[model samples]
Every structure is written in C-alpha cells, then in structure tokens.
Target: NSSVSCHIVQVFSNSDEALINKKLPKELLLRIFSFLDVVTLCRCAQVSKAWNVLALDGSNWQKIDLFNFQTDIEGRVVENISKRCGGFLRQLSLRGCLSVADASMKTFAQNCRNIEHLNLNGCTKITDSTCISLSKFCSKLRQLDLTSCVSITNHALKALSEGCRMLENLNLSWCDQITSDGIEALSRGCTSLRALFLRGCTQLDDAALKHLQKHCPELMTINMQSCTMLYPSCSKSQMTALWFVCLAAATSQITHTHTESFIHIACVFLRILEAARCSHVTDAGFTVLARNCHDLEKMDLEECILVTDNTLVQLSIHCPRLQALSLSHCELITDDGIRHLSSSVCGQERLQVVELDNCPLITDITLEHLKSCQHLERIELYDCQQVTRAGIKRIRGLIFNFIGCCVILGVNCVLFC
Candidate 1:
C-alpha cells in the first residue's frame, strides 16, 4: 500500500511541474531572457509581453555585435534599437556589415555617446559623413578599429583627429585612402595617441611618419607592416617619382619634374626606407639608409626581392639598436646573414622578434646560433623548407630541457609563440 502511494505522489509532482512551466508569467520569462545574444533576444519578442519588455530593456541593449547580421536587416534593427535603447550602449561592433548607411551611423554616433570600443572593419560604405558625426558625439571612445575601411577619406579622418583627442588604440590597417594630410591632422589633434596600426596602407610615406614623430611624441607602438610607401626606395630618381606621386595624389594636380627631382635630392638622406614590395631596394639603397637613419631600431624587409645577405650584414652592423627585425620572403638571405646576425652586437641584446618566414636558405645551423639570443621572444620560421625535425627538436630541448630548472618545472619558453 505504501509503494503504490509513493508512485502516485511522483506522478502528481511531474504534472505540477509541467503546469508551472505552462503558466509562468511573461515578465518573469523576459527577466530571465535578458542574458541572451542580440539575435536570440530579438527572437524572444515573439514569446510574450514580458519577453518583449526584457528585449527592449535599455540596459540589455547596450552591447550590439552585428557581425553576423544581414545588411538590410541590420539597418532596420539598428534604427529601431537606436530609437528605443541607444542611450545606455557602451560597445558596438559593426564588423563587415555593409548596409549601415550614413543615417544609421549618425544615429549611433548621436545616441550612443558613451561607446568605449567601436569596430568598423570592412564597412566600406562609411564616408566622411559617418566620421563627422562620430566626432560630434562619440567623445569618450578609447579603442577604435577601422581596419580595411577603405572608403574613409581624409575629411572624415580629419574630423576624428579634431574630435577624439583622447583616443588610445587606433587601427587604420589597409586604409589605403589615407595620406599625409590625414596623419598631419591626427598628429595635431590627437596628440595623445599611443598604439597605431598602418599595415598595408601603402600610400603613407615618410612625410606623414616624420610629421607624426614631430607631433605625436607620446606614440609608443606603430605597426607599419606592408606600408610600402614609408619604406620608399632610396634613390634620387625614385624619391622624385615618389614625391611626385604623393603630391599628385594629395592635390589632384601634376608636379614639375625638375622641382620634384630637386626636392628628392634635398630629402634623400633624411628618408628611412622600408623594404616592402620595393623590388628596387638593393644593397646600394641600404648603404644610403645606413648613412641616413643610423638610429633605426626596428626594421622589416619582408618580400623585398632585391635584398641580399650582404645588405643584412651591413644592417646588423650599422643598426646596433635594432630591436625587432622581419626578413620574411627575402630569398637572398642565407646562413651568412644569420651567422652575421648571431655574432652581431645588436642581435645579442636588443633583437626581440625575428620573422624568417618562407626563407628556404635558413637551416638547423641558424637555430643553433639563435639560442645565444637572450631577449629573443618571438621567432617565426613558418614554411621554411630547409628547417627539419632535428632543428625543431633542438629548439624544444633548449627551451624545455633544463636540468637545474627541475624545481621550477613546466615553463616552456620556446620562441615561436
């Protein structure tokens, strides 16, 4: 009799739980749904009134990650959300969303004034109008990532320069449309800028960087990866052509060939050439560079087809304060250059990160000598055809095979990571 009563009680409890789920209040459901993603939260509006209120809550609408949203849908959603809940928003990521027009961006800029981080990567539709509005409203913005946003011209950047004076980390990678005027504006306006990325922005030449060095004295880290223009080819003729290109590109007017030539020669020694996609940068150009920027601490000669081990030898000897070095895809660099690097005074103390990617000339012998480097932290030898298993094994042993460090245990200090 007792066992039968217990079974009946279990069935009643199961039915009661189902009844509670079915009769749950809409407000309670919405309150519980506040922690969902934007997509999921928007869908919860179909559930009931309480769910709708929760979805529309100003606090819950602060962060908007529209990376996966459809462009047209994103525009409509942003319009609705901006009307209802833009005041409390702190972070907005519109990465790769193309439908965000000037109007929608303006709405965000005006309404979401407290935004801290704004990522607009690959949003090619944004023009100077968008930036102008952001400047007028988003004053407290700290981290702004504008990577690959090619449509943003100088006028919009100038607006940002005047507006976001307190900006810290600003990424303009692949913004090929930006020129010296934009950089000059930034240097004059946002003097507090710290970290800046100009990767693949090939049009930024030495004039802009020199201006930045003059004004933005507080700048700490500047990633100039693939900015071929800054590392211009060292020659009177090349410099003349480069200046002509810069002038013509900036003013939309052609320059006199003779005047360009004269200026090129006058500024030849002042230039610090980068070996990025410049096939003409040979040993001769490096000789000029060595004479010019003897204080150069960071050098990257990636894909510089003309650079040889002879140039590296000279660079290691001359650039004694060199800290970070990238010689990736320079086929001419060999064990001779590596040996010179290992024996170099610069290589022993200051060198931190060395990228020898795809250089078939490097071998196990290079690894053996790299162990001498004390400050060396990151070493990228990705796809080096000559690097064998034995070389990597030796590297692993050096980083991990410490006998006296047995008490310290599992601290693998391999340079690759």
Candidate 2:
C-alpha cells in the first residue's frame, strides 16, 4: 500500500468508497505522519493540497519535542503552534527555548489543557505567572521540568501543588529560590509524586527530605546532588562548614540535574536515587535511605566523603536491587567496601556499574573482589594510584566496557578502545 498515494490528487475525490478505503485512508496516513519529526512533517505539508490538509492534522501533533529548536524557536512560533494544535497537544518540550516566555506559555497552557508532560527547563524568563496559568488550566499535567528556571520560587510550587494533582514526576533542579515551605506544599499536594530532582537547591535542608519521605511515600527516585544541607546527621559545626565549602564549589561544574523519571529498572517502580556531592551526608543518612528504599536499583553517592564502609554494608544488606553505584571521591571507602558490595545479592545478578574513581584507599585487591559481581559491566578505577596493571588485568574480564575509563600504570597509560 506504499504506492496507494500514486493517485494522491484524485483519491480524495474518488466516489468509490471501497477504492478509497482500500487505498491509504486518511486515518492510516495520519498514523504514518505521526512518526515524522517537525521538519519532515513540514515538508510533507508542502507536497500537495491533499497532503497539506492531512499533514497539518492536530491529532498528529499530540507529542511534540522541540528541544532541537532551542535557539531557533520563537514566541510567535510557539503561539501559532498552540492555536494550530490546540487541545490535541498532550506532551510538549520547550526545553532551553529562551525566546518563549510567560506570554507564549500562557497561550500554550490555555490552548493545551490536556498537556501532561511539559519541559520548560532553561526558560529563564518565565516566572510564577506561568505556573499559575498552568495550574489554572493544565490539570492533566503529570511530569513538569523547571530546571534552571531561576525565576521560579515557592509561589510556583504552591500553584502547581494546588492545580496539578496528577503530577507524578517534577524536576526543580537549580531553582535556587525554592525552600522547604515550597517542598512541603508540593509534597502535601502531590502525594502521588514518585520522582523529584532537587540538585543544587541548597536552601532545601533535611526538613525538605522529611517532607518528601512523610508525604510522598510512593517516591521511588530522587536527586539530591549538591544539596549539602540534606544530611541532618552532621553536627551544627560540620553542617555549617559543608554548607560554605560545597556551595562555593557547586557552581564549578554547571551541573544539570534531570528529573526525567529515573531509569525504569523495575516494572513495578523505578527506584533510582542520586545524592552525589552531598559532602555532609554521613553513613546515618544512607542507612535511612537503604532501609526505606529497598528497591533502589541505581544510586550515586559520589563525594559523600563522610560515608564509610558501614554505608556499603548497609546498602549491600538491604538494597538487593542495586545495579549501579558511584563511590567516586569517597576516600573512606576501602577494598572492604567493594568486597561487601561484590558479595551481595545485587552483585550476583543485578550489579552492572561500579564507579570507584579517585578512592585512594582502594588498592588492586578491590578489583579482585569485584570479580564476584557476575553482571558487572563497568568498574571505574581511573585514578587509584596504588592500582597496578597486574591488579586491573586480574579483573579485566568482569568489566567489559572501558569506554569512559582508563588507568595509569607506571610509565604507561591503558586506554580502552
């Protein structure tokens, strides 16, 4: 039926119902058009009068990701799209589209009431007004990404909480203006929330974590990277010191925390947790996390310097579904920690990625212990000065991928191709 459009111009006018129905009917053709990207769809719209009508169908614009047009997308274009697609638009991503502001989003929200997944990350010009509009209109909204939307504050969270009750996943990463009050409001209202990303939201302390844990019990995934105020286990003095040091360095990497529903490892609930660079986080914090989040499949504890081998023991014993772990820069972690992880149930069947980069305490013996992790695919040991070629060669078979890792041994450096 690929050639059914050969008589494209005359097909629409064909009086024979059977002849037209047997050929590429409008519904099936639109279904085929649904797969095309914006550029190709536009080209198809220019093919002929028949194709133009078929191609411009709003049903085919239900899910649109304009992330590629970050620099080129204009507010006029966005407004035009809102009118053209109207209620047919369900999911749209204007991620990094700085040109489109509150005006365009207001129009969009009014037109696309059924919008479920909206990514406004990097739309810095937008403020609480946009959220109010979305709250007033888009009740069906599910996942909302406001990453790097600096103008967003507690007021925005308040609006979203009041309106978008169905919201399940939200990314407020790098929104420094939000506080525990906002989080509490969001947690209380969005009780069905599962994944929340708050990396670099330094104002959020342990109080915010408590709010999420108490209200959002269904929460399976969270990113608290660079959220130094999270660890309540640290003493006042330690917390103050960590607050100063971590915040000073938080802007170093220009990190972007994605709240995109954490890796869906388990069909039941994708339990992924990331607390990387939470320098003040002690073993007590991780112990609580491991106990409560037993289904945790992926965890990033990189630079959580206060964590010791006890943290590993807790994870190994409780979190049997752990598949990926990053212990980079956790100097307290020794070979024993790796052994504890490698001997666990996760190591036997689920463990896949182990990043131990910059852990000076670990020697070549850590590699030997990792051999027990049958499913281990990548082991990061890039800067363990004590590790020799002999030790890496011993466990090289277990770690099959060397794409992002290399080791320095003596005068020679081993690079994986």
Cα RMSD of predicted structure 2 = 7.7
Best by lDDT: 2
Expressed as tens digits, the lDDT of each residue in 1-417 for candidate 1 is 999888766544553243333577656655566678887887865555545566678777777887877464456666676777777887878888877668888887887888878888887777778889889998888788888888777887799888887787788888888888888998888877766877767678767756666676556556666655553222333221111012111211112232233233323222223445545456666655554455666666776666788877887777777777778788888877888876788788777767887788988788777766667766767777787756766665775422222111113423332
Task: Give lDDT tens digits, candidate 2, residues 322-396.
Answer: 999888889999999888988999877788888887889989898778667776666677688778777676556
Against the reference, the lDDT scores of all candidates come to 0.66, 0.75
Cα shift from native, residue 221, model 1 (Å):
3.1
- Listed per candidate, the RMSD to the true structure in angstroms reads 9.9, 7.7
| Alpha carbon lDDT at 301, candidate 2 | 75
lDDT value for model 1: 0.66
In TM-score terms, candidate 2 sits at 0.76
Once fitted onto the true fold, the runs of candidate 1 whose alpha carbons sit more than 4 angstroms away are 1-36, 43-48, 200-202, 225-228, 231-300, 304-326, 336-364, 367-417
